[model samples]
Target: MKFGARNQITATVGTVKTGDVMSQIDLQVDHPHGMSSVMTTESLQELGIKPGDKVRVIVKAIHVLVAKE
Candidate 1:
Protein backbone atom coordinates (compact mmCIF):
# COMPACT_ATOMS: atom_id res chain seq x y z
CA MET A 1 0.00 0.00 0.00
CA LYS A 2 1.08 3.56 -0.62
CA PHE A 3 0.78 6.37 1.89
CA GLY A 4 1.62 10.04 1.88
CA ALA A 5 3.02 9.86 5.40
CA ARG A 6 6.79 9.63 5.68
CA ASN A 7 6.96 8.63 9.34
CA GLN A 8 6.48 4.91 9.60
CA ILE A 9 7.72 2.39 12.11
CA THR A 10 7.68 -1.39 12.37
CA ALA A 11 6.47 -2.71 15.68
CA THR A 12 4.99 -5.76 17.36
CA VAL A 13 1.59 -5.74 18.98
CA GLY A 14 1.86 -5.48 22.73
CA THR A 15 -1.76 -5.07 23.77
CA VAL A 16 -5.23 -4.76 22.28
CA LYS A 17 -8.01 -3.02 24.08
CA THR A 18 -11.39 -3.00 22.40
CA GLY A 19 -14.30 -0.88 23.32
CA ASP A 20 -17.81 -0.60 21.91
CA VAL A 21 -16.84 1.75 19.09
CA MET A 22 -13.07 2.07 19.17
CA SER A 23 -9.97 0.07 19.92
CA GLN A 24 -6.62 0.99 21.42
CA ILE A 25 -3.51 -0.70 20.12
CA ASP A 26 -0.22 -0.70 21.95
CA LEU A 27 2.92 -1.45 19.99
CA GLN A 28 6.40 -2.38 21.05
CA VAL A 29 8.73 -0.63 18.64
CA ASP A 30 12.37 -1.45 17.98
CA HIS A 31 13.40 1.64 19.90
CA PRO A 32 13.11 1.96 23.64
CA HIS A 33 9.88 3.90 23.29
CA GLY A 34 6.47 2.48 22.46
CA MET A 35 3.55 3.72 20.40
CA SER A 36 -0.22 3.66 20.73
CA SER A 37 -3.00 4.15 18.22
CA VAL A 38 -6.76 4.50 18.48
CA MET A 39 -8.99 3.42 15.64
CA THR A 40 -12.46 2.21 15.01
CA THR A 41 -13.44 -1.29 16.06
CA GLU A 42 -14.39 -2.10 12.49
CA SER A 43 -10.93 -1.25 11.25
CA LEU A 44 -9.36 -3.34 13.98
CA GLN A 45 -11.48 -6.31 13.03
CA GLU A 46 -10.69 -5.87 9.36
CA LEU A 47 -6.96 -5.77 10.10
CA GLY A 48 -7.20 -8.73 12.51
CA ILE A 49 -4.73 -7.19 14.89
CA LYS A 50 -3.65 -9.37 17.81
CA PRO A 51 -0.95 -9.67 20.35
CA GLY A 52 2.40 -10.64 18.81
CA ASP A 53 1.39 -9.55 15.33
CA LYS A 54 3.78 -7.29 13.51
CA VAL A 55 2.37 -4.11 12.04
CA ARG A 56 3.47 -0.79 10.69
CA VAL A 57 2.58 2.44 12.43
CA ILE A 58 2.03 5.36 10.08
CA VAL A 59 1.91 8.89 11.35
CA LYS A 60 0.63 11.76 9.24
CA ALA A 61 -0.06 15.04 10.90
CA ILE A 62 -0.09 18.77 10.23
CA HIS A 63 1.60 19.77 13.44
CA VAL A 64 3.50 18.29 16.38
CA LEU A 65 3.67 20.12 19.65
CA VAL A 66 6.60 20.12 22.05
CA ALA A 67 6.82 21.54 25.57
CA LYS A 68 9.49 21.81 28.22
CA GLU A 69 9.11 22.36 31.91
Candidate 2:
Protein backbone atom coordinates (compact mmCIF):
# COMPACT_ATOMS: atom_id res chain seq x y z
CA MET A 1 0.00 0.00 0.00
CA LYS A 2 1.03 3.58 -0.63
CA PHE A 3 0.68 6.50 1.73
CA GLY A 4 0.84 10.20 1.03
CA ALA A 5 2.50 10.70 4.39
CA ARG A 6 6.25 11.21 4.07
CA ASN A 7 7.15 11.30 7.78
CA GLN A 8 7.57 7.68 8.69
CA ILE A 9 9.51 5.98 11.47
CA THR A 10 10.05 2.48 12.72
CA ALA A 11 8.62 1.99 16.19
CA THR A 12 7.76 -0.83 18.52
CA VAL A 13 4.24 -1.24 19.75
CA GLY A 14 4.18 -0.27 23.41
CA THR A 15 0.57 -0.75 24.24
CA VAL A 16 -2.79 -1.57 22.68
CA LYS A 17 -5.94 -0.16 24.26
CA THR A 18 -9.13 -1.04 22.48
CA GLY A 19 -12.67 -0.01 23.20
CA ASP A 20 -15.89 -0.86 21.48
CA VAL A 21 -15.41 1.53 18.57
CA MET A 22 -11.91 2.96 18.70
CA SER A 23 -8.44 1.92 19.76
CA GLN A 24 -5.31 3.66 20.96
CA ILE A 25 -1.86 2.28 20.23
CA ASP A 26 1.24 3.53 21.99
CA LEU A 27 4.57 3.49 20.14
CA GLN A 28 8.15 3.41 21.28
CA VAL A 29 10.34 5.30 18.83
CA ASP A 30 14.03 6.08 18.86
CA HIS A 31 13.31 9.51 20.27
CA PRO A 32 12.91 9.99 23.98
CA HIS A 33 9.34 11.11 23.61
CA GLY A 34 6.77 8.49 22.54
CA MET A 35 3.75 8.66 20.26
CA SER A 36 0.28 7.26 19.95
CA SER A 37 -2.23 6.45 17.23
CA VAL A 38 -5.99 6.30 17.48
CA MET A 39 -7.79 4.16 14.96
CA THR A 40 -10.97 2.19 14.69
CA THR A 41 -11.12 -1.15 16.40
CA GLU A 42 -11.82 -2.79 13.08
CA SER A 43 -8.69 -1.32 11.56
CA LEU A 44 -6.70 -2.36 14.60
CA GLN A 45 -7.93 -5.91 14.21
CA GLU A 46 -7.16 -5.89 10.48
CA LEU A 47 -3.57 -4.97 11.25
CA GLY A 48 -3.34 -7.57 14.01
CA ILE A 49 -1.21 -5.22 16.06
CA LYS A 50 -0.07 -6.13 19.57
CA PRO A 51 2.39 -5.00 22.18
CA GLY A 52 6.06 -5.52 21.18
CA ASP A 53 5.18 -5.75 17.48
CA LYS A 54 7.19 -3.70 15.03
CA VAL A 55 5.30 -1.15 13.00
CA ARG A 56 5.71 1.93 10.91
CA VAL A 57 4.44 5.19 12.33
CA ILE A 58 3.10 7.58 9.71
CA VAL A 59 2.64 11.24 10.57
CA LYS A 60 0.74 13.71 8.48
CA ALA A 61 -0.60 16.98 9.77
CA ILE A 62 -1.93 16.27 13.28
CA HIS A 63 -2.85 12.67 12.58
CA VAL A 64 -0.91 9.53 13.43
CA LEU A 65 -1.21 6.22 11.62
CA VAL A 66 0.34 2.80 12.13
CA ALA A 67 1.15 0.11 9.60
CA LYS A 68 2.08 -3.40 10.60
CA GLU A 69 3.69 -4.19 7.29
- Cand. 1 TM to true fold: 0.86
C-alpha lDDT of candidate 2 relative to the true structure: 0.91
Candidate 2 Cα misplacement greater than 4 A, ranges: 61-69
Instruction: Give all TM-scores, in the order shown.
Output: 0.86, 0.80
Colliding residue pairs in candidate 2 = none
What would you estimate as the lDDT of candidate 1? 0.90
Off by over 4 Å in 1: 61-63
**How far is 46's C-alpha from truth in model 1 (Å)?**
0.7
Per-residue alpha-carbon lDDT of candidate 2 for residues 1-69, written as tens digits (9 for 90 to 100): 667886888999998999999999999999899999999999999999999999988777556455796
- lDDT of model 1, residue 21: 100
